[model samples]
Target: METDSDVELAVRPAPHPWLVLREHAHLVPMISLGGALGALGRWGLAQAMPHPAGAWAWATLWTNLGGAFLLGLLMSCVLTVWAHTRYVRPLLGVGVLGGFTTFSTAELDTRGLVAAGHPGEALAYVATSVALGLVAIMLGLGLGSALLRRGRPRRVTP
Candidate 1:
């Protein structure tokens, strides 16, 4: 025999397609606006800071590291203190940070460094970027989580 839980599940109506779309309708605009601004900032940085010959692309490296850190912090804040806010995660984490970080440009920079007779620099850049990016994320995560915990209400046990 079906239990009450089973009966309740069976009687519940599935959400309509229109309702699903409406639920996520805000994502498009939020992501779009954040992405546009993020991309524009990246482009402006690239233009303003030209890469030196036979060396690392400091701009891209900085961008990726900063973006990764921001994403980690954003996620921590959203999942903890700002959990009640719906759109902050999508707009900042997915839209802005996603657009700000450029894997394609990073790869191109590495390749160009190698092609420009700087294989050592290319390897160093790649290694440093990956290593530092990981560290940035970890640092951001730790700091954000600490701040979140500090701001939260603590329970007093008897």
Candidate 2:
């Protein structure tokens, strides 16, 4: 014997995949544009400050740190000031910042340093990058939030 719950479940039709895709179709272009702009910025930075193999990847380190900072700031804005702005997070946080930060390149650089008999430098690079990245993100979040607070109008007490 079929229960009422079973009957209800059977009566409800599943949503079509195309409809789901169409709902989020607008986000694709925003992400794409942000990613392209970020990639170009990163490429320009790398070109300006080229680093050879087995050396400290200053460019990658700075790029990742900058991205992390920006992501934190963007998140603060998104959660507070831009809460209703649907595309802001996808465009800036996921696309632009994602493209700007290169984890693979950082790993490759670390490996190259290790292979080149500079294990100490590799360890230092990795440690400093991770530590600094964390600090940078925290700083970004704090600064963004503080700036937002300052900009907000305070209510006067009677």
Candidate 3:
């Protein structure tokens, strides 16, 4: 299996501006679908497990972080197991999951917290989320890196 640097080198040899957009196009509907599902799931979660303080803020945080973890897992699987197709990466990963979770909501939540005279808590929430989100991604990536090693295509009989 290639090292992280090698994995990147293998894939990053070419550059394409339009390619990014194209990838997004593939992922748009998937992202939209993920968003719909995620929103509904969030609503259910919120109802089932209401936050102690800020309902919206907590819910949004939960959703985004959850989505990020899911994304990490998905990307790892697709890259390692499903063998990402041209359409899958952009549409499913980029569009659906990216759309499903949000940074904008997090920003809005922080803004609300500040406006409501809880700057300290707001900052704390932001900090905690950022730290946790990154950690979650790292965990996902670590798991994925292992999958990458394991999923290296096996030899086929001629």
Candidate 4:
């Protein structure tokens, strides 16, 4: 039994992936620019604080932690302050922070430490990075919320 609703559903065309991409094509430039700048900043940090193969990768550690904090802060601002602004998330969150943070490099650093017969150091590094990254995000979110509250004008009713 082919009802009118069933016929309409069967005749409806599925959206092409290309059309979906085209709809948000305008964000490409912002994301690309942000990503480039983030990568450059990460590279500069690495250059400034280069470590040996088996040593703690301070540069990568700081970069990841910083990126995580910034992401949390940015999300808070986006939700509370810039809720209506388009492209901020795609540019800063998806692009800049995405480019700045390097999980692959972190994994490689851990592997290097393990290969150099420092399993304990590797474990400690991983644990410390995860713990500190989480703490950093929480701090960032709290700071962002506090700043927003401070900036707002309070209403007084007597």
Worst 10 residues of 3 by lDDT: 6-15
Q: For candidate 2, what is the lDDT?
A: 0.89
Clashing pairs in 2: none
Q: What is the C-alpha local distance difference test score of candidate 4?
A: 0.91
Model 4 pairs in collision: none
Most lDDT-accurate candidate: 4
Preferred candidate (lDDT higher): 2 or 3: 2
Worst 10 residues of 4 by lDDT: 2-11
Residue-level error in angstroms, candidate 2, position 32: 1.0
Q: Which segments of candidate 1 are over 4 A away from where they belong?
A: 1-25, 153-158
As for TM-score, the candidate ahead, 2 or 4, is 4
* Candidate 4 lDDT tens digits, 1-158: 75686445546677898997799899989889889888888899999999999999999999999998998899899998999999899999988998898778899999999999999999998998899999989988999999999999999999
> For model 3, how does the per-residue alpha-carbon lDDT over 9-47 read when each residue is reduced to its tens digit?
545456587887685565566666755765666667657
Give candidate 1's error at residue 155 in angstroms.
5.2
Worst 10 residues of 2 by lDDT: 2-11
lDDT string for model 1 (1-158, tens) is: 75676445546778998998798997889989889888987888888878876567888998999988888788788887779987888788878888888878888999989999989888898898899999989888888999888888899999
Provide the overall lDDT of each model, using Cα atoms, as 2-decimal numbers.
0.86, 0.89, 0.72, 0.91
Model 2, 21-100: lDDT tens digits are: 79989998988988988888889889988998899989999999999899889889998999998899989987899888
lDDT of 1 at 73: 86
